[model samples]
Target: MRRKILKVLALAPFALLFTSCEKKISHEHREVHWDRDMCERCKMVVSERNHAAQVINKETGEAYMFDDIGCVILWFKEENITWKDTASIWITDVKTSKWIDARTAHYDTVHQTPMAYGFSANEKKESIVKDSEILNFEEMSKRVLQRGR
Candidate 1:
């Protein structure tokens, strides 16, 4: 009827306004998406067990994938010329397939952990040091190994 058509027409503008005001979620934080064949860095087969890699991005969903923890740092320090907002480092547990934040992990001087970076081969446990305690490559090298060649 004409009344029904008028009711729908009146509601249409309000509906469009609500839809236009809806907040859009960014895809920047989505998990790493890539071909499952090989690591984009080391050229090794992407293994779900042994070594692992991850992609980090922000704002615009620009992802950068790597083969090892070392590679991740190396890529950030070298390859990625593009601007990045924030980065998340994904480290696989030596015993478990679970991923942990590498930026906030305890480093052991005796136990060898898989995919460990630099002298952190001796990682004791996961996230033992807390995020604030972690140091960058240059600083960690000086702290863990001392300043030298």
Candidate 2:
């Protein structure tokens, strides 16, 4: 009985140490279900392979999927997400349909998007016409906010 009590006490701190630590949240993009997963804001099925966006709360590592950048923009306004400035936004490259860092990717505002946002992300993978204007993340967000649609 004394040996059993000592063993329990010896392992208690290790158990406590493991349990007390907070679960680490991943800042990376989550897997998309494509045509099955619904948008967090608009509730539309995320079917557009090239236009889907996901915003991950940097602090909590929670990902909110969106069918369009327009929905993402409006969701920021509607929800007043406190972590907006620090959030990690992921968007698919227009040509490759692969996830890319949205904040760092260049955008051209000419394509027809799912939500009519008209902004397509580029990792320089999508060939643009000569002298086509490219917008940064901040600029694109401002334009989307200004459009107010």
Best by TM-score: 2
TM-score of each: 0.52, 0.84
lDDT of 1 by residue, 70-97 (tens): 5555555456635433555455544454
Candidate 2, residues 38-116: lDDT per residue as tens digits?
9988899999999999999878788889998889988999888888888899999988899999998889877899888
User: For model 2, how big is the CA root-mean-square deviation?
Assistant: 3.5
Off by over 4 Å in 1: 1-35, 48-50, 81-85, 108-149
Worst 10 residues of 2 by lDDT: 124-133
User: Model 2 reaches what TM-score against the true structure?
Assistant: 0.84
Q: List the residue pairs that clash in candidate 1.
A: 111-122
What lDDT does model 2 reach? 0.88
